[model samples]
Target: GGGVAAVLSFGVANRLFTEPRERGRTIGTMGAVVGIVSGGGALLGGALTDLIGWQAALALPGLSALAAVRVLRIAPATQPRAERLDARGAVLCLALAAALAVLLQARTTHLKESLVLVLAVLAVALAAATVWHVRRVPEGFLPRLVVSNSRFVLAAVAGFTLFAGYLIIQFAAPRLILMDHDLSVTQIGLILLPTGVVSAILSRTAGGLAHKVGPLRLVTALTVLSAAGLLLAALAGRQPVALVIAVAACVSGFSAGQVALMAAVPHLVDSSVHGVAAGVFQLVFITGGSLGSAAVGGMVGAMSLSTAIGVLAVVPLVGMVAAVASALMVKRQTQAPAPAAGPTARPAVGAE
Candidate 1:
């Protein structure tokens, strides 16, 4: 998805710039831009669909894409030419992802379809093969250098947990808003506005706090807060005022924590493979969101709405465990003395 692309680009750009504070500001601005565009699109699309046909409404975005291509063609290349494209690995990875996507669609949307299981199994196999191939192949799809770092692994796990919690809440929010409050889509967006706005405003500030208090601690605290928020939302379900506040708390905390994560991940990784590390982090976060959406969607479909919301809360609880592990790991690694590079020269006891 283009949203995934945009966020990945933001991560890579932060790595390239190597300025933490500026990266926070840039990401905040990007978030603001996204909020505006998404809000506008919702309103405009609704209007267009109501006035004209849905097909005609879709044509507008197609026209916009044509204009976007022209703009992109004129844009200057900032990256070095030395970067080699891993064509085979890329194709294999994409194919595996496509298969997984199809399987998910079939399982969720077309339950009667028997081919989903076969596709899912094939997808898993292809993905495993892709990973194996990449490690052996020079300039493969996955950047080998990035995966070597323990920090990258930690960051990815933390990112996964964080996004899982956030997306689960996101999937549940609209249902709660519509069913509990009997609000229109427009009203729901307006109610959600404060959460997004506060998050955008606070993220840079959160980044600053993270710099002072450390991302590991900030992330842990935020993870706890996110879980608490979700629990509160679950308890406050069908209660209009409390539900809104609870959802706001969940969204704002999760988003601010993401900014802190982006800032910390690059520094945690080896400098030589920073770009690839950031890319991996982004990919993990996106994949986690997908999984979270699926998990939440399924729970909502099968169980009661309150149960779905409560189950979603467990995602952030998992995030708390990850955050605590990451914090302890970082502390242990940071505090531990580095081994001497060479054998220490022994001073003769008599000479001393």
Candidate 2:
């Protein structure tokens, strides 16, 4: 949860430090750094666990927290309105979310406990009260305008689909590699490396494409490609040659779509609301990720490998549908003329 909070904080950071060209490089660097640390730490930690004992893994996270503190101290802070941090609303939300988290965990653990059931009901009520509070409270944590925007709603849905597909692939691929094809962990990592490297290289190009072609067209193309790639991956399953090609396409399409979507966001809505809109989209994305992990894992356990792959492909297919809908809406919006202002502000008559 704390890790998720840190990642969420970076969304505001991204919007704060907005230079089109530079933003891409910044995200890429941050992504690369995270990838190296996560991957390298796992590799070293595992070795240390085997040789030096189990406590070595604990040091990695401890060190990471210390590093985060140092970085936060040095990092520039951009003060959005202090009012944006609604204390009462935050407390209610945290309580509700924590309850749900506990209840979800309970299903797999001590299910006989009445406390879990009680907490679940309490969470639902608290969430309802939170919504009511948002409506009535002046200077609350959530802004009414943020929730009311149609574009934000659509963007949130799209973000959910994008991350759902990503999480599904991440969970499924390793299983397909290890159980079906008998590949070692090192080999699985090696196979996955190419996709991440390619994404890092192509992210800048994707951002440029978003600007030049307009986000709708670029995103639509990428989303379609993503759907196709997932479908292909479903078929490839355990076949190494086919799996590699399919995974490459999936990674490229997903990365490109993400870049285009992020670029489109500021253009799709008011700049003042960018931080809130982005945060909502991110929240949905994280929710979808959790759902995807559970859903995919469940399907894989219940059905055969082929069936699991088929189920996983459905997420990207939904994304393709959303992409088409968004493109059409954008086109319609573009074709509409801007409303004229006050009578005196109207375009000059016969001036040209």
Candidate 3:
């Protein structure tokens, strides 16, 4: 599921648009669709689970997949290219994910100490191997140009960090609500519905604004808003109304920030490498989400859920700093003068 999403996100966005303005609009529209589906899915799932059964609710995603087949047929195909599969990189990534999952389980559950130690060692080994492999290979799994680009790196960091914060909220909120307020699954879904709606609206608007104000500026501002929302959620405690407002703000900001980062991808990398760049970007984005959910879940097991959520709020502030740094880098790159023409340079036809 993760692999497919990463591939499709990069392939579709890269193939569909070239110019930044158009890309922003397209990416925004994509975000809106995702927001709708994600938000609506919760409501739909709850209704299905109540009316029918858990099995019926689980089947709904398959139906949506069948519907998506028609959309897939309309997608343009790319020219064939001879590219080596990065099998070692793929294995290393999977190992890392598995090890991380085990470690999270160890932290949250009463697992044997020896098992936890072994998993920790395995996770460290996988991380070291992935880094070494990337540096060793000429044409590595990730493109060198994409990795070296400061703006792209910062954007990736911002995306990962912001998503982590968002996922933490999603993981912790429902549990907190149920524990404190005794809300049913359906009631919890309803409480969270507004967040998705606001996110969908902001995501589309942010895309157009990214073209006008620049993605970094918009992302930075939105990230700060998200941070503020997290802080509010941290302080809200058991207040249902406050929690709803905070969730809406956080989701809206996350949606906008996501659109801005994605819309900036084409501008950051060459057209030819968009597919690879997008894949790397989404890989990190997805990894952040997993780490966020795991880390916060573990923390909740160790301490009060409210305290864990409060600490997790700091993640988005870190993302805001990365966004600001990206904006500064963009400004510097823009202001740097073009190299002076050499003697052999062709003269302008209209030279005075």
TM-scores of the models, in the order given: 0.79, 0.76, 0.91
Name the candidate, 1 or 2, with the larger TM-score value: 1
lDDT of 3 at 228: 76
The backbone clash count of each candidate, in order, is: 0, 0, 0
What would you estimate as the lDDT of candidate 3? 0.76
State the local distance difference test value for candidate 1. 0.66
List residue ranges in candidate 2 displaced over 4 A. Answer: 1-9, 12-16, 28-63, 66-70, 80-84, 87-134, 137-142, 344-352
Q: Which digits, one per residue and each the tens of the lDDT, describe model 2 over residues 1-352?
A: 5436544555745765688667655654554443343334334555666667778756666666666676677566766764455778868866765666556446444556678768878988998998898788743655667665555556556656666666666667667766566654556666666656555555557766777888657766655665665666687757766665565556555555556666776756678766666565556666666665656665654576557656677676676667667666766777999986876785578866
- Model 3, residue 130: distance off in Å is 1.0
lDDT of 2: 0.62
Local distance difference test scores for all models:
0.66, 0.62, 0.76
For candidate 2, the 10 contiguous residues with the lowest summed lDDT are 33-42
